[model samples]
Target: MSRTAVYNLPARWLHWAIFGLIALEFAIAWTMPDIHRDTRPVGLVAWHLGLGTFILSLMLLRLLWRGVSGVPDPHPGPAWQDRIARLTHALLYAGFIALPLLGWANASARGWTVHWAGWVPLPALAAHGAAWARPLGDVHQIVAYALLGLIALHVLAAAHHHFIVRDGVLRRMWSSSR
Candidate 1:
């Protein structure tokens, strides 16, 4: 891959950082005790909440960075394929941004305090016992599963480019250095 095709250093960094955090969040979510009306934000639940907030903050930073710096020119490809790639990227961003807010709102409804790393307090998205926010936890879970599907599609597409299409698409955002 040519150096010019690569994303800027911070974009590359944030991409991987967010990916790692998302993986960790999923693992914690899978293993943590099931959330209920009486559940307290402790242990894995606290970690999950803090990490979700952190991921949301990083994603917002990433969006700001993308806006100011913009992405490198896309790898040349068939128009339809390019469109699909763009859509996939957009959906990924949407999912990452939305998932946390849903979780946060649900947390708020449950009267759970969402602190950043167990110290700094983050604002609640909904009032305690808010009916509107009650369903968001389920929505969050459903979207999480859908986002996993999108992630799988993304990896498969990258693999196709790397192994079959023999394109440099994967390397564009793979790392800071080629």
Candidate 2:
């Protein structure tokens, strides 16, 4: 490994942080009581909302940091593989940003006041009882499932790079140093 082969420290840090947070979000979502019109943000629902907000904030920060720090050059690979990798990464980023916003809109439609990290109040994305945004909850869940598939593809690709291709692609983010 060489310095140029891996992501910068901050990029790697943000990447793993978001990964861990999203994993936690999924776990909380699975155990949380189902959201209903009259449901109050308590217990796991509160945790889910707060964590979603935090994930959104972190994604934004990660995007900003990525813009500032850029990224390491892509490991040498087939052009098609590179294209797929790029598309997958783009969708992952979009999914991360969209999930929370969709949930926020859905929450607003349900008249829930979402807060960032359980403190800073976030503005409602939709008016209370707005029908248009209500469907977004379903969309949010669908996109989440799709994103999970994408993540699986991503991890498998990384493994392929490490074992089959014998490239440093996986190591690019897994390790901080050469």
Candidate 3:
């Protein structure tokens, strides 16, 4: 296995930060029913909606970073393997960007307020969409599940390469140092 520079510290921080928040958000949002929309306590929903806003912002900035700095080279792999890994990462990015917007859209369409980290209020995207909210909400949920699936495959593949296959892919991502 060859060495490649790990992600930049900022990218790494954002990656792991969003990763933890997303995992927590999914666990809470999926396991529990939608907080009666109106009856749910502010503290709890604040975290959910707040983290979702954070994810949205981080993903946006990450995309801009990628557009400018581009993807860091992975530890060397076969052409097909590299392509698959790249494609998978692209899918994850797309999911990261889309899921939050869908949730926001659904919320917006329903005229709900989104809080940023429990403090800031986000502008609504739509006036109201009584009928559309359910479907978009469904889309948001479905995509969240899809993101989990892709994320699992990604983590498993990273682990497999690092442990079983004795590859340096994990090292390149695990830390930014030599």
Candidate 4:
């Protein structure tokens, strides 16, 4: 099969969709609890849950497609550069897996249904218990913070490639290169 040119269309959609969702998810995760109940935290929390479900579902599909279509070639760079890319991606994949599970667990522990949007309900991965969910939420928050930091680094590296290295790296994933 032909290797995709930079990102193929599906990859592009997945990238932006996940990027936006993750950013919004992080924002809600950090600030909701401190706000008063009369405020809008409930809606924000629900939106976060809905988006997290979307992220997790699309991620599974993306992984399947990645397995079938194969990954684009790693950008050519120094040895340390390649390792950084690999490690960053591993962390991302781990967060993708962890975030939703933690959210679901948190909801379940708090006696809320694991609802996917206002439609299609998801069953709890574990029985209801604060003992289980609170710490999972804590870990989820930590991982989300880590994801934010890594994303900043990822963006800087991409920018460095575009401006400093003057390579095709950013164009492959950012613009139409065909």
- Against the true structure, whose TM-score is highest? 2
In candidate 3, stretches whose alpha carbon ends up further than 4 angstroms from where it belongs are 1-4, 31-41
Off by over 4 Å in 4: 1-4, 30-42
Q: Compared to the true structure, candidate 1 yields what TM-score? A: 0.95
**Per-residue lDDT over 92-148 for candidate 1, one digit per residue giving the tens place of the 0 to 100 score:** 998999999999999999998899755689889999999999999999999999999
For lDDT, the strongest prediction is 1
Q: Residue 126, candidate 1: how far off, in angstroms?
A: 0.5
Number of backbone clashes in candidate 2:
0
Give stretches of model 2 more than 4 Å off: 1-3
lDDT by residue for model 3 (1-178), tens: 4433677666777788878888888876765546455544256555777878888888888778767665566667688888888899899998888888888877777667887765788888666656656578788878888888999999999889878998677666568675
How big is the positional error of residue 148 in model 4, measured in Å on the Cα after superposition?
A: 0.8
Models, CA RMSD each: 2.3, 2.1, 3.0, 2.8
The pairs that clash in candidate 3 are: none
List the candidate numbers ranked by lDDT, top first. 1, 2, 3, 4
* Alpha carbon lDDT at 51, candidate 1: 91
Give each model's whole-structure lDDT. 0.91, 0.90, 0.76, 0.75
10 residues in a row with least lDDT, candidate 3: 32-41
